[model samples]
Target: MALEQLSEVIQRCQALPENSYTSEDYDLFTVAGRTCIEEGNSLQLLSIVLDEKNQEIVQCMGWNLLPPLVQVLLKKENKDLPHCLAVFNHLIEVCRPKELLIGLLEQLEHDDPDTTAESLHVLLTPLQKLLNLGVRKASSLGMALSSVLEQLCKLPVPETTEQEQDDVFSLGQCCSELSAFIQPFVEEAQHNHIRGKDSAQMMGDLPHNEDELRTELLKCMQVLSRLLLGVQLRDMDTLPESPLRDFASSILIGDSLPALVHRPLLRHRHIPGFLEEEVRYPKESLACIAHLLFVHHLLADMFPTVYQELYEKTLVRVEDCGLPVDLLEIKSFLSVPQNLVKVMTICPHQNLRSKGLKVFQLSIDKFNTEAKYKFFLMLKTSNHSGVEGYIIKNIKNQIDSALKAEGGNVWFEGLHLLPLLRSVLMLPDGPETDLLQYMDIMESLNLLRYLVIRDKTGIWTELYKIEDTFLKPLRVGINMSRAHYERELLITKEDKKTKAKVSVGDEKLPNMTTDTHIKALHSALHTFDMIESVLVRIEELVD
Candidate 1:
């Protein structure tokens, strides 16, 4: 109630042994144990405690003061928001001590006095109160939490360079404490924002929402993304297995990164008009999707699970997010066999895939021959049944491009995508739909034609394997095409007979020309002839 009483609590806190004190007692939810702010000197008491010049008094008051003050501040009265922010600023300053920050800046200027960065240990415990008070469920608490998060972003995170390639950043060290609280907001906000699109939105005009609650929530997500980026850049290449780097990743590489990655997809249009003008981490290319590209590269090698998840989500978002993941440039993300499966099954984005395969073909020499085996295993145990044929068709397109792309690279002699072709042609004898099986057979023959035409010597070099892989598919495609063509021809003839028998007057099929079985027969014959030519070329190369 008075300065003397505050001093006594401070003395007790100061006298405790290191590690003697417990975490904040969350039950202390009142202003000195009363709900009504009208009855206490809560504001005055906080101001006095904050003003105490003694470092020990301030540190002692910290664990006890803000957690309860926030209970009152988040009670939805407009009068209390400033008080909450003041308490928040006090705690942030206490943790990110001014002296510590000035010391970091001074070291940067001098670049001589080696100084260790401050640990954010002091802020972690008391700030856990926000976690206890779920921000999204309590609108008042969400507003207060948003204010605290914005202030956290404004603080400068300093960097220190140990070597030319090694730079460690400061605020990333604190993200672990903040990640849990921040992630919940992303899920709740995305849920609320995704409902109800009108005719205007369908026509590509912006969404309309009067609730400005999301502006702060969106700002928090952007801040969280940038904070995670700081954490990533701090320790990306840190010697494979260092505790410091690993600690930073534990926070940044959680569920948050994966969920936040879909931000551009879930919330791109919903971003309010005000935010569009001054977006901090603006959609340099579709916001979170673009940012996740950097995040994936930094953590993909160390955390394969992260890479797999990001790769899959990236597949779903390629069209909306503008195809930001470049697997060829970042070999680590695509190194896994399962990731290869994901790549093979991405159904949309033909142009992205086409460009990607060219890049991959150009870099085939950079990868070991082992990548070929991985792709073979992927297609052999192909998981995405719906899209594997499409994958096969696209690979032929790549092989054609590679054969067309003039280069003297040694890898060009061996198509990087050939193993996938092997797996496609070697499909098990099973009863899928006729159209599906026929499509698969045709894709194999077409790819084989391209291979035999461009690099007959390469095809012949693997002739023993190619015998089972190519010749069988060629036989199947030719036989199936003939059967299908003959059946359709008979059906058309029967239909004509039925129509003549009816003798209906002058409605002559509405002047529409037919796609006759003869046309299909011709196309099939052309494919069969090309495969035959490929076999001859292979024979010549072998001789």
Candidate 2:
């Protein structure tokens, strides 16, 4: 019934004049995609269309019909395994449901590694869309990726036969294609405006739903990140026989680092006809690549050596390019190290700290106004919630050590670290408390004290001297606390008296004197007094 409805919709759409069908066709296609899944029988029809034996039927279904049908099959629950698998195999051959194919590729990465690798190759034709989807789905997809990667890492190097080399080469081709596809999407995700609801919402307001486009793009990036990391690790062992050895070697040798770092301006000189067509580049590619590199550096053992070479190469390029190199590219390159610092702090390695510190130093130097602000914001947000404990702890330690070693002076002088500090103070209640304890107890106290002293005597003294200025707000807060405590005390005493009066005939009334209530009142008053005292001390210094 569902397939019949879909067929009716397709026929109706096909009957419309070509010029008139543009908008109507899209609506029909969307409905068909949705309905095919709603009615379980859609898969049976899709199977017929996708079957190799029914080439005419497959060709007649056309590209438009393929994507939605694939979507239906993919989304179907309690689906017949044989039918679904057959449909999937056909979809791979036709590359009709490009989006669904990308989704499956990502899903496959988490399945058995050998199976996933084969699946990845089969789905490689629509490499660009696949890469975009990988990036969009990276966060959710990261969990299952390591297993497939582990298998790829275990593949035998210097294969005994030509076929073995060819298989490895095929995998490399998939990786390269996948990498190119996702690179842009990752870049966009990074530059995604923090002020907006999200990249998807922003994209939605445009012609098509930007959210879906971005989501698909991110999924692609994630898949690419996993695939590239796996391929790089695998090829590292097969350097002699690997087709990707040169590309891998180039990355290792730092030859590609400059191009990658300055990728915004560099055209793909190697790709034929790239120069002739005016292809509008996607914004997220570089950002995505940087993230991929950062992740590889963080998770894979091979990245440190690769990153070191890349880092040195980047520094050289910056030096030669001078101060006015493309700010966006520079920001992207600088972010790699900071991300590594955050990643290493949680994961930990004795060797990583120095590398993290080096990157930190470089970030401090190269990070401009916008970059600095964004970094602090990320620290603040990461510190708040959705951040791991070890990472938070490591970051706190790094910040503290930097501050104690006068690293604070550098951070303060160059970029404001106060926002990052503010985030630390406001950390969400969780296991991350260990990280907070390190800073909240002593560091925050010291920082607050330092600010108080600086306001009194330093360049900020005049700001403190003004009436109803720096110290006034603290006084107001103290007064509010005192008033709130008084109100609570009154309520407690009234409750105690009411309870004493309501005692039963046989039950003697306990001492319901508001003593405990009074004690709490005293404690609250004491805290208010302490706050007042701190403010008074500041007022005196201003005088």
TM-score of 2: 0.33
State the lDDT of candidate 2 residue by residue for 110-185, as single tens digits.
3344444454444444443433445434432222233333434433332233444566435565445444434554
Candidate 1 per-residue lDDT, tens place, 366-385, comes to 33334433443444455455
Worst 10 residues of 1 by lDDT: 110-119
Question: TM-score, each model?
Answer: 0.32, 0.33
Give the whole-model CA lDDT for all candidates, comma-separated.
0.45, 0.45
Count backbone overlaps in model 1: 0
Q: For every model in order, what is the number of clashing pairs?
A: 0, 31
TM-score of 1: 0.32
